[model samples]
Target: MRGKYTIKEINRIPELLKKGKEYKITYDKDKKYTFIGCGSSYNLGLITTKMLNKNGYKSNVISGGEVIVFDKVPQTDIGIFISRTGESTETVKAVENFKKRKIKTIGITCTADTTLTKVCDETYIFEFANEESVVMTGSFVYILNFLLNGIKKIDIIKDAETVLSKIKEQIDTIDLKKYNHYVFLGYEEEYGISKEGALKIQEMAIQNVEYHEPLEYRHGPKSILNEHTLVVINSKDTKKEAKLAEELKNMEAEVILIGKGKDIDIPYNNGYETPLRMILPQYLGYKKALIEGYDPDQPRNLTKSVILD
Candidate 1:
């Protein structure tokens, strides 16, 4: 089951979302929040932080390693640590630093009864979203939806089904060997989605990838655009982003735009729909890995969790 678990996990995103735990924890709208995680979980925090701040909830994001190594935690009323496995060393240990500051602590993970649950003031365990693959996939979307939608009737499952159905044809037909350079573009919360998208390709296909704001690419990064370059734009449904997509296409780089009436039907929805955009890149990564003959189940130099001594 080299690529089997990866495929299975990605396809089961809707099922996992259906099983997500509702947001039962009380929150203080006036309090400041800081989210901590690593890799995909970090990206999740980034997206959530953007959404939270935009919606008038004061929030920021930090990496667990920063707290562990630099002791640099943003002064916040709450520290929300996220880890898929609930046992990431930096995230687990970083809790103490926030606790020392007398900050309220929260933990979010897929596995239950792990160190995170024991250490944080509160823990959210999405046991249904747990996966065997080292790389985070369905669980990422599940947690993101939980934090954002909170078991709301958002119909993310339907959006995901639509994306996966359409993206399969588009991604499967691509010659993965020809595309050596990949770029992801977005703004605001979508930028975090772009980061996660680039990461999916990098982890599965071992490709050189970059992510930037749409206009930022026009700076110096556009110099790398070529026929071998593939660009994915998580559009903000703005004219400027659309124009950038057209410019990149004219430059002969393949472009995928996920916005209203774009390559993918799901609109930016002010970043609420950004969770569905994740499916496209995930499927693309899986296909590219199969093309590269690497087992998507096990990526190079990665483990299900990072447990430092």
Candidate 2:
């Protein structure tokens, strides 16, 4: 499943954007909802909740396996569940519970026939190549695209589509074999993406990496800086990011900055509106992993999805 999205499949993001805009009006409820998932899907759940808020909808999160044990569930309005594969039992069970409560459910999954889809009221499937490995790569990006495009407000799908296209161009040409260790930094909502990017490197490249808040990095995580480490900072302020880059430079750490402004001489610099910008590094890191002889489709010891009773 490495490089599962051909340039063509990846390019369909623009049309997906259009479809999202068209379908956006279909969802007009501003009521409360819950998002469910496990592992990587749980990370996606966090992002989806943020998007729901941005679109004027109230939402909360509950781990898939613990839904029953958690506090009283909200009356279903717009339940969102994410799973790269549809069969994760926890997510499926959560969907069943939501349905029993007469909650409106929307499923985001990779497979069309998975249990989650079968139980959901509305489902969106990303057509990614089958992942041979336990870890997910292209499927994650595909789900991300669904979120970025599906949200009608904040209205920047076209811009994001353009940014992703340019990112793909840069990805196709860059040589990532130069770095051994990586550090991912993001403040606020983007921090989850930094964590995901760090996980990708750890799982695929078998490399050393850490994800920390930009400010937190200053407190202690900066000590590991060295030429072998790639310090990737996700920030909106380039000048502030440059200051951090300067610190990394002093420590001989290679710096890669992503976001707005002009502080550091960022590699693959591009502006993206809102938190969707965070997804770029996941795409960038995935490209790096493939070049490094790691199969993202099947990370060393991961499963398609984590299932907990």
Judged by whole-model lDDT over C-alpha atoms, candidate 2 comes out at: 0.65
Off by over 4 Å in 1: 21-26, 150-153
Q: Whose TM-score is greatest here?
A: 1
Among these predictions, the greatest lDDT belongs to 1
Compose the digit string of candidate 2's lDDT tens values, residues 1-309. 574543333445445445544333234456777778887778766666665665676767777878755634666577788877888888887787787778888887767787777888888775443344566554555465456455544455556566676666655564577778889887544666677777767875678889998878889777766678877777756466668877787887767666553322223322214334544555655666677776655556766776666
For residues 1-309, what per-residue lDDT tens digits would candidate 1 score against the true structure? 578999999989877766664545444687999999998989999998898888778889999999999999898999999999999999999999999999999999888889999999988888888998888988888778778873233667777777778888778777878898999999999999999999999999899999999999999999978999999999988999899999999999999888889887777676778778898889988888888888888999889899988
Candidate RMSDs in order:
1.5, 4.5
**Alpha-carbon deviation at 137 in model 2, angstroms:** 4.1
Q: Rate the local accuracy (lDDT) of all candidates.
A: 0.87, 0.65
**Candidate 2: residue 229 lDDT (0-100):** 81
- Show the lowest summed lDDT stretch of 10 residues, model 1: 18-27
Please report the TM-score between candidate 2 and the true structure.
0.75
